[model samples]
Target: MAAIERYEQWMARLLLFNKPYGVLSQFTDRGSPTARPTLSDFVPVKGVYPAGRLDRDSEGLLLLCDDGRLQARISDPRFKMPKTYLVQVEGDPGEENLEPLRKGVRLKDGMTLPAEATRIEDPGLWLRDPPIRERKSIPDNWLKITIREGRNRQVRRMTAAIGFPTLRLVRWSIGDWTVAGIAPGEFKEISV
Candidate 1:
């Protein structure tokens, strides 16, 4: 029975965490002068690490797992797992403005692969803490952007490259798993 329990513990485990804004994706704050909220604040499960990084400011679905192979499959750009984001940008953009994103924008790193970009109605997600800054003069627009590669701050950079700066960014899904039904700072575990 003890051996069976141990075997079960070693079995692949996955967690879908609804990462909130301003929270770091890592488990610890490391050497930061000021302590910042991290996964440890929300997820108490041991041995699990984030499969891919979500920037401190970005909110939404963040995958954590105990298996290294599973982590690599999710995080590795080579796997080309599609990551989709619901982005609110500063200005209302027409299809022409989003064309650059669909065709792949050239960044300082290199040309990105073409992505699926579309203007979307507000997804009406939960209100973010502290809220996004609002400008009465400029209208904001929502976009559903899906990309296969996980680049550092890629979505924000992509929108900016096309003349619309993202005001708020929420990662809605990573492949089949999504942030749906999970509230901020909460996580659901699953066995793989």
Candidate 2:
């Protein structure tokens, strides 16, 4: 293969990363006073960038790609790409409490598109680095929440809106790609 062809092949790669808690989605933490872990620490592959962000406090599947169009499709709201999450909320909410999320939760930004939300058994994920605080008197519930809109902290806010605040959040999948076997701070590459 020609040098240019090799470069193009490299650029067409897609990476599915299992982002651990407290890691920034970007390559660097330029503005923060304190240095923090970022993609550069986990992903050494050059050229690829995260398609969408998973907040520093949140963890799980994050797609990275060097192809701009593919990145846009995964991150852009117009594409309506479904992103699934395994959430641990502060209270034990019943199906009635999750209805609003399925119908569309009104957020400060606006009403979100209806989501696929359901209570789920513990997903048996690896332990979080710091671990979530446990309240003896209060119970937490696990939920499988899938949303098409990529809003900032949307899942956490939605749960709060329904009177159940999120204690922990993990992105399980985006479209057909999933974090199924990828361990924290690890990544797998796929061709576009």
Candidate 3:
């Protein structure tokens, strides 16, 4: 194939990555002593960039697109694509504890839109490394929260506002793609 044709073919591709904890979303981090390997370390694709960022402390699925148009479509709030997270909180979240999340919790930055769905439990999940601090006097609960917006640290902030601070946050799915069968630091390409 001609170089131009090959380039065009590559631009149409997309990849899903299960970002492990401590990795940066960007390719470089100014030689920071604590910088973790980024997508560039795993994906050799030249034009791809993350559709949205997952903080270094958070672990989960991250989407990348070689096509600039497709990246914008997936990342832009205008598209209104939803993202789901499995969050482990520090306190036992009761049905009442979920009311504010369902009703749309108000944060200092702004009122987060009500979660599309909220569940107090999810069966399949892995424990986080350097496990979250445990309080012998208190208990913790797990919640599966789905939201349309990818606000910065939104899940952690939302849970904390309700008095149950988040111990760990993991993005379980994004739009139609999921982290199923993919382990941390692994990735695969899929049709969008």
The estimated TM-scores of all candidates read 0.95, 0.95, 0.88
lDDT of 2 by residue, 101-167 (tens): 9999999999999999999999889999999999999999899999998889999999999999999
* Model 3 spans with C-alpha error above 4 angstroms: 1-11, 31-34
Q: What is the C-alpha lDDT profile of model 3 across 79-117, one tens digit per residue?
A: 878899888888777778888988898998889888853
Stretches of candidate 2 exceeding 4 Å from the true structure: 1-11
Clash list (residue pairs), candidate 3: none
Indicate the TM-score of model 1.
0.95
Model 1 agreement with the true structure over 1-192: per-residue lDDT tens digits:
999999897789999999999999998998999999999999999989999999999999999998999999999999999999999999989999989999999999999999999999999999999899998999999999999998899999999999999999999999999999999999999988
Identify the superior model by TM-score, candidate 1 or candidate 3.
1
